[model samples]
Structure formats: structure tokens, C-alpha cells
Target: MTFHDREEELSALTTAFETPDHEFYVVYGRRRVGKTELLKEFCRGYPHIYFLAAQEAEERQREKFVEHVADYFGDRVPRIDGWDDAFEYLGEKVVDEDVVIAIDEFPYLVAENDSLPSYLQSFVDEQVRGTESMLILCGSSISTMESEVLGHESPLYGRRTGQLDVQPFSFREAREVIQYDTEDAIRSYAVTGGTPMYLTLFDYTETLAENVQSKILSPTSVLYNEPEFLLRTELRNPARYMSILESIALGHTTPNEISGATGIDSGPLSKYLRKLQQLRLIDREVPVTASAKKSKRSKYSVADAFLRFWFRYVEPNRSSIEEASKIVYENTIGPDLPNHVAATFEDVCQEAIWNGIRHGMFDQYSEVGRWWYGEHEIDVVGLSPTDDRILFTECKWTAEPVGIGLVEKLRAKTKHVRWGPESREERFALFSKSGFSDGLEQEVDDSWTFVDLEDLEQMLSAGR
Candidate 1:
């Protein structure tokens, strides 16, 4: 719940405030990504009027907004009839002192009134252009916010002095809040991703199983119903969307595969996948060695880690959990949780590798992602712009230390990866749950990096 890691966003807002003229900032992201929290944090040391808009009549929202304006300016609540009068009154208040007027859920206002952004464009140009006061438009609806506020055709597009896309916290930032031990913490991140709101729901003192049993599996808990509720709230066809997500989480990645699994036609399935992609609920991935636009091997996966966890464990076994909650955890999810977490370990290692690049531990990477050609698959591939360095990693979430044989097998996969020239230096990284054996340690060289669970933790900690 406490604010951590948004210094970059905070700094951007602060810099905007320090600029000489009036500033209009478009701040946006998906719901529960902490846009509101970041905005509130930036407004902490300044005189500001924070107005949260809602789904209501334009008159109701205007009335509420004017009241917020009135409270900030120490004036009586006026019976404002229109946005023109509201802007005029607000303009008068911002003339002498700098006061930020942040409209949270700005898209909601546009939803109620289509011409609201046009009205804002005129207001900023005529009313607040030369004033020191700032205006921030924040929204949870990513598509609505971008198209309405930041799109080229939008009236308010060129008017914005700055924009901030508030993203979910990184795994490192998530770890700061989710203070479990290393293994459990990774499991927790696999469940929650990096969303601030979701991270707060976890209690570090409790074991992973305890949290899953109580926070997610229990019928009354928020997480138990989260993915279903979120889809219903965000998408018009919730049942169909749920089916598609469950299919992807279950390992049906391609369009035809998903269609066969869900019985949805590929034509309509594409639209659903596009919508989910736009909402950041699903991500489309091509191999690291291939161009995404032209690749026929593109695969779609659930982007939100928690949604993946929900669809995989909760959605499938809902009936079993309803029948017996305690038995369900021990019998169903508990046994398979390790495998679930292991699936996510490759991503965690890639994150650490990127962090390593930032801190000079790893060579520079122009692109880092999974690469697969036919039956050959490389877990993590980091390509360099320099053409001199290419890194391939194999992640093993096993109980025992990785031996030289496994490393050599990973080395064998590198020959199939066709990116740089054959002479290009290919480096290998092995990430393991337990560690590397003494025999494998002898094989470590300039081209090889061994990352155990603790070493991975420390690598992530570098940025934290």
C-alpha cells in the first residue's frame, strides 16, 4: 500500500510543474496500475484540486468537478450550467498561484460528453495557456485515454505539454512490497505480476500456500473472482473472453489451436485476441530471432501473470474448490504450483538479465526474448546491436544442481539459432533453482554465466 518505485514518474511530474508556463499532462494506463496513486503522490507538496470523474450524466460530473474546484479556491459552489463556465471559474483561480487541476478518469468525462476534449483544447489555449497552474488528465481506460486524449485526430492531442504512461511495477519493485523468501517471492510474482494493488494483498509473513488458500482460493476473496470480474467489467463478451484466456493459459497459443480448443471461429477469435492485446491482458510473441510482423510462428499468451495463474489453477478447478476448499489446495493447486512457478522462472531470469545489462554485468542486448525454430527451443535469447555478442540462457527450476551435461545441451541449441554471423560470439547463461555442480563450475568461462536462485535474487536486487 505504501508508495515505492515511481521515482521516474514523480520526477517527470515535478519537472513539468517547474516549467515556466501552464502544463497539460496526459497520464494514463490500465486499471489498478497505480496511475491515480502516482498522480496523488505528485500532487502531495503542491496546491492541487484532484477530481475523480465517474460514469454518470455530464451534468452530475460537472457539478462534482465544480465543487472540487470551489473547495480548492475557497469560493462558494456555483450553479455552473456548462463546461465553459466551469473553465472560466477555474481559470480565474489559477491566475495568481500555481494549482494543479487533475481530472482522474478523464475518459469517463468524454464518455458522457464526446466533445469534452475539444472543450478542454479551447480552455487550455484560451484560459490557462500563460498561467503557472497545471492540468493533468488521468484515466484507467487505456484505449479510450489514448484515442481521446493522445491520438493525432484528438483536439487535445497537440495541446498536451507532456504525457506519462504509468506501467505496473517491475519484479524488483514488486519484491520490495512482497517480502517473502526468494522461492516463495517468485511464486508470488508469478501470481500477481507487478501490479501495486495486487502486491498489497499479499502478506509476506504467511507462506505461499497459506496466501493462495486464503487470498485466492477462498470464494469470498477478491482474487478468486478477479479475472472473471475484470473481464466482465472490461470486455463486452466476458464468457467468450474467459474461454479464450483459459485456452491460452492451458497452452493453446496459436489462433487455430485456440479456435480448436474453444470452438470459436478464427475470424472472431482474432478480434477477441486483438481486444485482449489492446487491454494488455494478452501478449502476442514471435521468436526473438524473427520479425514479429512477418512471423508465422507468432503465439499469444496471457500477459497478466495473475490472470495466467487464475485461469490455470482457479478457473479449471472451481467446482472442486467449491466442493472442498481445503482438499482442493492440497490435492489440486499445491502439487502443481511448482510447475506453474517454474513456467514463469524463465521470464524472471530474463528480467534479471536486463537488469544485469543496466548494471554492466551482462553485455548489451538489443532484443531479449524466447526463440524457437521447429523443435529447437532456447529459453532466453539476448541479441546484441554490436553483432559481437549473443546470449542464450536455459532456466531450470529443478531440485538438484545443474550439471555440465545440461549446459552442453544448451550450448548445442545455440548452433540452430540463426541471428548473427557464425563467427559472432555466443554466450551462455544457465539459471537454476538449486545451483550448478562443482563439475559445472569448472566449465564457467567469460562466455558462460551461472545464476542460481540466490544469485538471481541478488541480480534483481541491483536495481531494487
Candidate 2:
């Protein structure tokens, strides 16, 4: 697949190349998030040596690195006895010329030899600094990368000149990559969750149900066991993490609820939750109007849309998938997928609103998130604490036009949100899949901004 969006990352690398000195960059993200692809794109025209570290013994990895360095120099070099000798050779060869040496999956090397970071630190301080060489260390293990490479106590703590935590694409970028109509694109993104590899696995030419059945629900599909594979690779005990994730997926959002459902003590569950949050697999959220940061009413939810969908549908119906039965897709997933997509659509709308704010299309806000009070909830709320202004927004994914009722309800809920003083300025924004009703169109004024699917598409395209 063609590279879609990484302009910022590429620009960063381009700036790094202009320094005319040594550059040490650390790039890390989860698997299949395009870390290697980003590095390869940056290294295209440069004289670079790219080495992918494998899960092998230290001796074997060092030998492989020796071969890569020899190939880059196009000469017979002496065998490397260890990492020190390897880095020394690289530093000597690239001293006079601008060259890049990127080691992908650096964690694999560290797994084999725990002192690889120390060796790298020593080499960078002793030989590579003040030279015209660039070194990029990339990895996929988020926990390991944080604790081993970028941690405060690590030997290579302050050696990196630049670092990037490459994340999955945003909703707008995902739409561009998928090339589907707004509604279908939203549905596809709900399952793919902005992951480039997952988006590429889907075929836009096919219907959503057909694609889901073939590319996701089927036993032979690449994404069938994708979440499982990721969790297993990242966690020492995958089963416990699975239980916690499943609990969250099933709507047990609080620590007490999750612990009750998973039969794990809150103490141990908190540790697991922290690890999951660190991995970007789950997120903790409090009410947007909460006074305290650590509110007791905080909730936990799966951070990745794809993982949420998989845990909600696929993992629970694994027996049907293993039996190769179509009923699971038709009866279980097909019936409820629209509701799932609708929920994800709210997220997409919020993202689009934020993008608009970034592009100067909307007024700046101090805080933006969902707001809830008692039984009433508002989908999107952008509050300006200093300016005493609040934007109350609602997102609808239905085919029927959103009438004035939603706007009225949103106004009613706004009264409950105690953000600023009583004289706070208020605005209303409504986003709908279908166009708004005639009554709503007539109600549009300076304070009300109605956005239909077409309007959203324009906003997304303009922001891009």
C-alpha cells in the first residue's frame, strides 16, 4: 500500500538531516503502526544502513549486524566480536560522511543482551558524537521501550537528540486512506481504528458486511487473531490481560466493576490497568466537568477502536469462528455493528471538531470532552474557562435527518453543566449523518452551527 500520511514525521527527519552533525533519534510505536515504514521513507535518498533486529541470541544478532554493515560499505570487514566492535566500526566508517544507521526493533536486541543500551550509550559518548553519523533506534514494545530506552535510569537516557512516538492515523487520515463514502468510511474506521495495516486489509469495493465476514470474522483472515497476537507479544501473562480487556469491553468501566467481573482484587487490577494504559490499549476518563483530576467516578475504556470491536464481538464468538460458522457474523456482529459504528462516529466527530479548532475554523477552548451529569449526557462539549464560553455539540449517525429535538435536548443538558459563572456565553453545534431537518436549518444563526455529512467531509478535506 502507498504511504498516506506522515508529513510531520518526514519533516522532522528532514530537519534532522540539515544539522551537519551527529543525530540520535528514538522512534517507537506498537506493531504495524508504520515505524519501519516511516524510517524507510526518511532514508530513501540518504546513504543509510538499515538493520532489523531479530529475536535471536546476542552472537547471532551481532553477526547479522556485521553482515549489514559490510554490505553497506561494499567491502570485506573484520568479524564483529560484540556490539562495541560493531558500533566502533560504524562510527569510524561514517565519520567523514553523512550517513544514517537505523536499527528497527531495538527491543529485540535488548531482550537478547540486556546491556545493549549501555553498549550503545558508551559508543555514542565515546565515538559517534561530534561525527556526521545518525543513529535511529526503533521499537514496538511500548513498555520495554519506555523502561529500557527512554527511561530516566537507562544508560542511554539523555543520548537521543530526537524522539517520536508514532501513533495510528486519525479519523480524517483514515477516511482518506479508505476512500469510502462518509457513512461507510465511518463504519470501516470503527473496526480498523486508524491502524494503517488494518485499513489496508479492507477492500472498499466490497460491502461492509462482506468485508467484515471475509477480512475479520473468518478464521483464515489476518485480523481474526490480531489482537490476541499483540497482547501475547506485549504481556508476560496474556490471559489475565484478556480478562481485564474483556471486562472493559463488556461495559464494566470502573475499577470496582472490572474487579468484580474479572474476579481480581482491585490492587492487582490497578497494576494491570496501568500497564494497559501505558501500552495505549485502554484509557481512563473522568467527567469533563469533574472538579478533581482523580475523581472516584472515573471510567476506563478500550483506547483502540479496533480492539474494542474485537473484544466486544470476535473474542466472545471465537467458537463460532473456529467452527467456521457464518451465523456469528450474520446474527451476532451484523445485527449490532451499526450501534458500534454509531458510537465510534461520535469519536470521529469530536476529532473532526478538534481538527477544525487546530485549523482556525473553531474558537479555541480550554477543555473538550463528553459531559455527563446524573442521567443526562452531552456528546461533545468544548469549554473556554477563561472566556466563559461553552460549545454544546451533538453527533447523530442515523439515516433520518436530525430534527430540532436533539438541539432542544442538548440545550436542556447544557443548563446542568456548571462550568463557568451564570452569565456564560453558550453556542450549539450539531453534526448529523443525514442533513438536518428544515426546522433546524431555519434555526441556524450565529450561535448555532449545523454540520451535515457533506459539511463534515468538507471540514475534514480542508483540514487535510
Candidate 3:
């Protein structure tokens, strides 16, 4: 499990360390997203002290913190009575030297003592400021990190030198971790999403079905109840959140539809939706061409691919899993898994396309996302509002080569998209898992870009 990507984040942290001024950085993301690992990697070869806070009483946590500080200093440090005392000890030890003091799972400490942030603010202002010490506060609770640490009313609002919201790896990064062919790598990513922890658990040598059965369907597996564990950790009402997530996974995307399926009122449902969105468990999507603020047609979908798979397959078949029924994996999961992967493959292709856009491989676009109108849906749309140009894309995740008929179908849908005037210049791109047909390759000219597995592998392998 070597660190694969995160060059940008590592670079930013290295820059923070190089600066002479004291730095207070807030880093937070969901569990197993590598926040702590990222900090540990940054602290390597440097004079740093990392303290992981546990879910314990305030006094107990302070004693542990004091012990860690003492160990770092190699001396008999006095017992810390409070956070202020702890930070004071830290400030004295790293006043002149470039030292990193990272507190992992910081929200656990905040939960024990509500006034921890204010104490931290005082410590930053009176002790750490103007020094070469860098204090990195890390947490997994997105809501707590947002409302308590970086919120407008937070005590340490203006005190932080920088903030890093670490996210899961993209498909390209995931490929580096899961060593497999391009098609199989895509399938593995569909199951693990971009989460490094889950990706590492997958045995690439085994068949996808075997891996799914052993690593996911088994009751003893680490990922068996992973989504439940995360929900319980972050939310007070885990059952309610689970119901909402299950509804979305079952294709109940609209508010009314979800409410109908879950038997929850729309008013309370909105709050649950907002909370889940804040946690990054689900996302609300409007049409790519529509204004986000004014768009009335919004669909909710599970944001994490692992959670999507869990809710769709595992959660519903918990009894079968407990009973060790092979039929559950072979009949139910095995049959529908490819279709699920197909949907996720579209997302991966969109990400690959976005990477191309960032590298100036595609025309400049103001926005890019999935677009739909009535019964027509375009997989990917890159819109350059100023230039009156739009790139409509279709992603096919099938074994067979995509033919010209699919391109024709995509072209027919493009005419219905109303972004600008009818004279708007249009570009078309197609991504296929198994390359394209000869007819498609010959029919398309310079305006059309056909991206297959080989092209995608090349784009992903550029920096490898």
C-alpha cells in the first residue's frame, strides 16, 4: 500500500513547512480517505509529533497528548490539565525549529470539550503565531469539521493559515493502486470507488466475482459493514440516513419518489438529504445546462461508489450473506454487477475526459457534467458559454466495439440541448471500453474524438 497520488497536496504542505511563519492547517475528509496518511507522509524526515485523539473523556485525552508530547521531546513533561496547557507545552518545544504538530481525529477532542476551538484560538494567537511551528488539525466528521472548525461562527475561523479537504483518489490514481488491465481496473474502481483502503483489500489476481464474494459479501470482511460503520460514526440517526441512501440506490432519485419509497415526509426528508449531502454521502444533480440556483429538476444519487454498491447489493441481501448463500452472489449480484459497473464506468470516463480538459487536450469549457432533456440524456457535456461551443460525449462500457449507430443516436440527442443559439458550434466525443467499429472510425472527422481503452490508458499512464 504505497502512496500513489497526492502530489498537489504534498507540495502544498511542503511549501507550508518551508515558510518561516507559523502555520495552522485544517485537514478533513471522510474515513479511510488517507488524511492521516497524507499528514504522516508529509511529516516524514521532519521533526514532527503526531497525536491521534480517541473517543474518550477530556482528561484522558489530555493525559495521552501529554505523554506523546513528552515522548517527542525525550523528557519528563508535566501533566497537561487542559488544551491550552498542552498547546503551551507544544509551542515552547517548537518555537524556533520547523516542527509539525498534527492532531488526528480532532473532532473526538472537540466532542469531549466543546470549548476546545476557543482554547486553540488563544494558543494560536498567544503562543504559536510568529513561530515556525505548524499545527495541523485533522478530522473525519465532515459536518463537525465544517460547522465547528471552519464555520463562520467558529473561534478559529480567521486563524487557520490554510485548509485542505482531502478527497478520495480519482480513477487514474486508483489504477496505480490496483494493478490490472484497463478494463478490469475500471471494474475494480467501480466497486472500490476511489477509496484507498478498499482498493488495497482487493486481490487483483482473482476474478472480479471472486473478489466481490470474498472481500465484500462475506460477513467477516472489513468492507462488509463499512458503509454502516461510517454512517453510525457521523450521524446520530443512522437508520434514517440508511433508508434515504437505500432509496437513492434503488433509483428513487427525486424528492417525492424517495419520500414515497421511504414513507418519510418531504419536510424532514429535505433535512436528511442536506445532512447526507454535507457528509458527501450523496449529491444533488441538476441538468448540466440548467442554472443550479433556479433548477427545479434535481436528482439525488449516492456520491460514493462503494456505498452505492453496498446499498444496492449487500444491504438488501444481508440475510443471504449471513446464511452463506452462494446463490446471492452468483444469481443476484453477479448478474446485475456488470450493469452497475457500466454506470460507474461512465463516471470514470467523464473524469478521464476532465483530466484531458485540464491538460489543454480539449477545447476550453466553462462547465462539464451530465446533461438530460426529456427522454434524451447525454453522458458528458462540456460547455464553453462564452465561445458558444459545447462538447457532447457518449460513454459505452461494453465488450463489443461501439458502432456508428451509437454516434448517430448521440448526435440526434445533441439537437435537443438548448444552451445557446442554433448556430452554436458543436463538438462530439465518444468513449468506449472496447474501442470503436470501423464505420465509426471512418465516419468521424477532426471534430470527433474517439477515446477507447488504449487512449484512456495512455492518458492515465503519462505520469506513471
Error of 2 at 266 (Å): 1.3
TM-score of each: 0.96, 0.97, 0.96
Worst 10 residues of 1 by lDDT: 228-237
The C-alpha stretches of model 2 lying farther than 4 A from their native spots are: 443-445
Top lDDT model: 3
| lDDT score of residue 98 within candidate 1 | 86
Candidate 1 overall lDDT versus native: 0.87
Model 3, 24-93: lDDT tens digits are: 9999999999888898899995889899999998999999998998898897979677788887887788
The 10-residue segment of model 3 with minimum total lDDT is 455-464
- The residue pairs found clashing in candidate 3 are none
| Residue pairs whose backbone atoms clash in candidate 1 | none
Ranking by lDDT: 3, 1, 2
lDDT, residue 133, model 3: 83
User: Per-residue lDDT for 1-464 in model 1, tens only?
Assistant: 57778999999999999888899999988778888889889899899999999989999999999999898878899888798888888887888878888999887898888988888888899888989889999988778887889999998878888998888877777877888888878888888888888888877788878888888889999888987666754666699999999999998999999999999998999999999998889999999989989999988988878889999988999999988888988988788877878878888898899999999889889899999988898889999957668988999988888898897788788889887776898888999998888877676677788898888988998855
Once model 1 is optimally superposed onto the true structure by TM-score, how far is the C-alpha of residue 16 displaced, in angstroms? 0.7
Q: Taking the candidates one at a time, how many backbone clashes does each contain? A: 0, 0, 0
RMSD of 1: 1.6
Clashes of 1: 0
What lDDT does each candidate get?
A: 0.87, 0.86, 0.88
